[model samples]
Target: MPSNVHSEEEWARLQPHITKLYSDEAKSLKEVMEAMERGYDFHATPRMYKHRLQKWGLDKKYKEKEVIHMSLLKKQREALGKRSIFFVRGKEVDWEQIEKYLHRRPDLKTKIRAGMLKMSSDSFDIVCRSPSPDPILHASNTLQYTDELLRLLDGYYVSSLSECPSGKRVNKVRDYAAAIRCFRRLDQARTMILANMLEPGFLALNKSLDDLKFVVRDQDATLIFYLCDVVTIFDQRHSPLVVELLRHTYGILQITFGESHPLVWLLRRLILLPEIDRYEVIATVVKAAVDKFERPGVDDRVIERLKCHYFLLLDHMASKGIKTTASFPEMDATSMDAVSVAYLGRFADRLVHSCKFEEAERKSDLMLPWLQNTANRQHAAWPDLQLFYLHVKAHGAFTRGDNKVGEAWLATVDQHAGRYFPNM
Candidate 1:
């Protein structure tokens, strides 16, 4: 195929696609290029395609400052300045903004007449009492209670996994579905939301991503690592949230900045987490990130960690007395190391919870020496683990009517608490 495939006839064909691309009420060049390639089947170097886009007056949409912000309220404000009505679908919705209309004084009369929408404030204060300080709802300028605003964001929590359009469902069958036809493609919206939605567990939300700052510097890679570290420290490796955040971040960054290696690196780290819905989050992230990278790199430690977790999950299932459906590797129960001890501890918990009294107590006995040795060896290190062992041991003994042994265990913990947890 010739590199210069943009012949006169080709240009005529390409022109329609370019016009459609610009007419799209969309943000993000990555999506535009994808639509051009997949939908239009227009093949060319990125530079050539972009040059053609520029020639067709579509380049302006890709520029950060020039691209329209998708928020409709923002547009109206920019056009009409302040003193404009907070409205929705041509209806005046500012219940409080109506208060300005009550005054009939001359100076206020002519100025108020220029208003497009106005409403009266309610004085029906019926002693609205709350047990605690209501913060978010009462915050001025955030009219969350307004019917119009609620119309847009109502029922946002309709489970994204739901497939059927069910009865009395206030939400779209798909989340934020209204934006797809206007702002970006559903897939593109999904990618962006995943990568950048500043959920609570993610890093500080205040970080600047304007002008593609985060995507350009590959900052989402740092976030992935940070999130992975958090989930590890908190022993939330199997947490769905961690996986969701990673999955979304990877997707969003994939389109925003194509072939991002750092994003893939974080994704591999994420897939290793024990709590992730493996078939969903792992498969999704891996497929998307792999598509972007020619040679997706996998860390050796990540693989090892995954294997350990795989067996750990199996061991856990066995402890619960659930039939192991697969031939899974088992951790040796005889080992006194932390990992093995953890397995023993979980086994004890399962037995106890299932009302297997003697079996649970026996596992506790089996764990005692390992716990004592570990606490004595490095009392300063992993104090939480040590405390957990001691507390469980004492609780187990007390339950079995061995008060003397339980008291001794408590004395040991108190001694350690004074040394290690001085604040307590």
Candidate 2:
């Protein structure tokens, strides 16, 4: 069997299966190949797959220009008080890139809306009728529109960062802060409008709020830290925007100052923002970062950090009884930093609370060096380690029938309780 050769009988047998997977299920070419091998024990070369797909008219992708044309036509319909929906091969267009193009070509907007200019392509249809089960399609279309609007807003935010003059970023940021408050009000109004209409209105609201968070990340490298602190103080909630800003800050500092930079580690820990069932996004990002740094011969310190965060996130989710299949990665703690150690300490404390004393004790022993160091006591995570160690020691002593030692450790925690938790 040559690589490019495929028999007529084989194609006749597998053609429908391939079409179902490639078109209906929307799997990529590689994924389709892997699925075929696993499910049908069929093996084919890429060229064979491509040739068969072309011959059978299974190409589902919209060309870049076709997408541009569809987007423009869609916008043109919107201007004329008519809705124009588009689908390329049974899926929606990539609204993000289309929105970027619309933002980049403001001059074309007037010509397009006024019907003076148009783009023609055969790759899509100007769908006049609504999709079947109209309400569901309406909700989806609403979300798609909201996401596009949010991206356009982000583009404006990036422009503000780019167009600001030297020595006046302070004023510019101050104005931006004020503008965000107004934007929030407008967001509230938009939410109200949708809330009156449908049950999935809050989904749109959440999407808008989530998208607003990444706007601050488009800053010049120098102003990242200052702007991050300001935004943190300005919005006292654990908002998605702050997490995205921290992620952006982490990338910049990791590149400019290297992985060993304290700010990099801080941002690494701070960047953990996993939504419900969306923790894989964090894992994927961290793994990619690990690959990027490893390609340059960097150590696996970042992996240690990722493992700690992953465990802590799992613990947090477990406490809420939200189960996930994400597992803790195997980690080496020989050179773990204070922040990473703190995350492990927090995880250990959760284990202690769950009555997993033996594992908690092991974790305490792992942090013994950092716990005993006087200088480490001044570190921010020192109290977390201290609390974890004291709790584990008390639990261990009580289990071993050494009541006095357990009481002593308990006494130590009570003695320092005020200092460790003054507000509590």
Return the top candidate by lDDT.
Answer: 2
lDDT of 1 at 411: 94
Q: What lDDT does candidate 1 reach at residue 327?
A: 30
| Per-residue lDDT of model 2, residues 1-424, tens digit only | 4244568898878987887677546689999999988898788988888888877765445443464577666654432323445666566655564554444345554555455665764635434332232112233344444344334333433444436676433222121222122223223323233224222333333443343344334342223223223223212222333344455556656666567644455345334323321233333333333333333332345444444444545444453344556554543466555644554555555465566777877776777776777777776556645655665576556656779998998888666656784542
Model 1 TM-score relative to the real fold: 0.28
Q: How many steric clashes between backbone atoms does each model show?
A: 8, 1
Candidate 1 deviant stretches above 4 angstroms = 1-308, 314-323, 326-335, 350-357, 374-376, 379-384, 394-415
TM-scores for the candidates: 0.28, 0.32
What would the TM-score be for candidate 2 when compared with the true structure? 0.32
User: Tens digit of lDDT per residue, candidate 1, span 1-424?
Assistant: 5254667688776665555455444435676667767776766677776676565544332211111111222323322211223333344343332232222122333333343233333322112111231122223323322322222111211221123245322121111111111111111222222333322112122121122233223232112222232222211322333343445455555565465344444343444433423222322332232232222353332332233333334433343243334332244444445533444554554455445668767765665675566443563224544554565566566656789998998899788768765654
Cα RMSD for candidates in order: 24.3, 26.9
Output the lDDT of residue 261, model 2: 44
What do the candidate models score in CA lDDT, each in turn?
A: 0.39, 0.49
